[model samples]
Target: EYGRDNGIRLSAVWLTHDPEYPENLPAAPLVRYGWTPRGELAVVYDRSGKQVRSFTYDDKYRGRMVAHRHTGRPEIRYRYDSDGRVTEQLNPAGLSYTYQYEKDRITIT
Candidate 1:
């Protein structure tokens, strides 16, 4: 709600512990939506409010799944360059990629 309403991405969703393990981690109903903290659109707090993930968008603004948050995964590790470009993308397969951006373009291998 706060992310879209003011363009301020909600960093944390603090809540008390519930009787559910991985199923009840969140204390409230999960609502998915788009978020932009600094003009970076993130599919944060997706439906069920239990999952979150980020991706890169092409010029056409298509959602490309770059990273994500899932149940049983309590930690997230990702990085972006000073120019608001993704420097690293980590996936479960250990298949990750680094981006090298130079003057309005991205170089990926």
Candidate 2:
């Protein structure tokens, strides 16, 4: 992450809650409701810590998400380029969305 408000680096050392003992992580959560072991569920400020992104957790660590909370739920997926840029999104119904980059921003077209 980059800086918070007041142009300070996001590197300020802090304490985080541990479900276990002794192992510590970053405190000062970015979420409002709460956070869990998987990480915060609210909003994510990327490495730049400027633009925010919405995120949710999947039970699996890799591969595709087999099931989700939404029904009629498309099998949403991301196709990444060699550089890891998300190049496409495809749905189960065969509908697709192409992605392109504009400056530092990513948008689905």
Candidate 3:
């Protein structure tokens, strides 16, 4: 399989077969990737075409991931300060954590 972004190989899995039955072996995609218009990875799917994860980017900040969701896992979210530094994080357990940044140090709580 190839990615739509740059024609790059995304995922490829081929079954092995006997030498005489090479034609019986077929290549299959183990994973698939979906890209945003700016070429950012937006979503992922398993070989069965089940959604694995999806990413959400911040509209005001390019390339900034504001949240992501994974199958069977809790969704994680992030909040960025004006400087584009992560200021707050919400974990899968619904706990909120805050971060502070200084010129040369970082403080998390």
Candidate 4:
């Protein structure tokens, strides 16, 4: 199913556990999508409506993904350059990868 707000689309989608499951249980009990007002994916829930994962976006960067947190895990973050290219990614383990761009090649360090 979907909800539209002015021009946004695809608010939610139901998935099946098994295509050949019985008619009464063709689809999974519950799986939901939560969308931001700007049409960005915000969170996902399981059958009990518990958040499975959540996402955060950078409003200043044309909706570029800035961070994402999963249940029981530390949030991962990203940084972008002025050109909107990803410059750094920091993971839960505190390891960070930095990206450098050249005229024809990209390097990670």
Best by TM-score: 4
| Residue ranges of candidate 2 with Cα displaced over 4 Å | 1-36, 40-69, 102-109
How many residue pairs clash in model 4?
0
Candidate 4: regions farther than 4 A off: 1-7, 16-19, 23-30
Tens-digit lDDT string for candidate 1 (2-77): 2235545554444445556656666553565565434555655654664455444443333433345554553334
Model 4 misses residue 92 by how many Å? 4.4
lDDT of 4 by residue, 18-108 (tens): 4676455524436677888777889988867788999999886657999999999989999998889999999968778999999999999
Candidate lDDT scores, in order, read 0.54, 0.47, 0.78, 0.79
Give the per-residue Cα lDDT of candidate 4 at 14.
Answer: 56
TM-score of each: 0.35, 0.32, 0.70, 0.75
Model 3 compared with the native: what TM-score? 0.70
- Candidate with more favorable, higher lDDT: 1 or 4: 4
Per-residue accuracy of model 3 over 8-31 as CA lDDT, tens digit each: 534333345558887765454667
Q: What's the ranking of the predictions by TM-score, best on top?
A: 4, 3, 1, 2
- Give the alpha carbon lDDT tens digit for every residue of 24-109 in model 2: 65455442222334443433333334434333444544322222223235546666665556687777777778888878888887
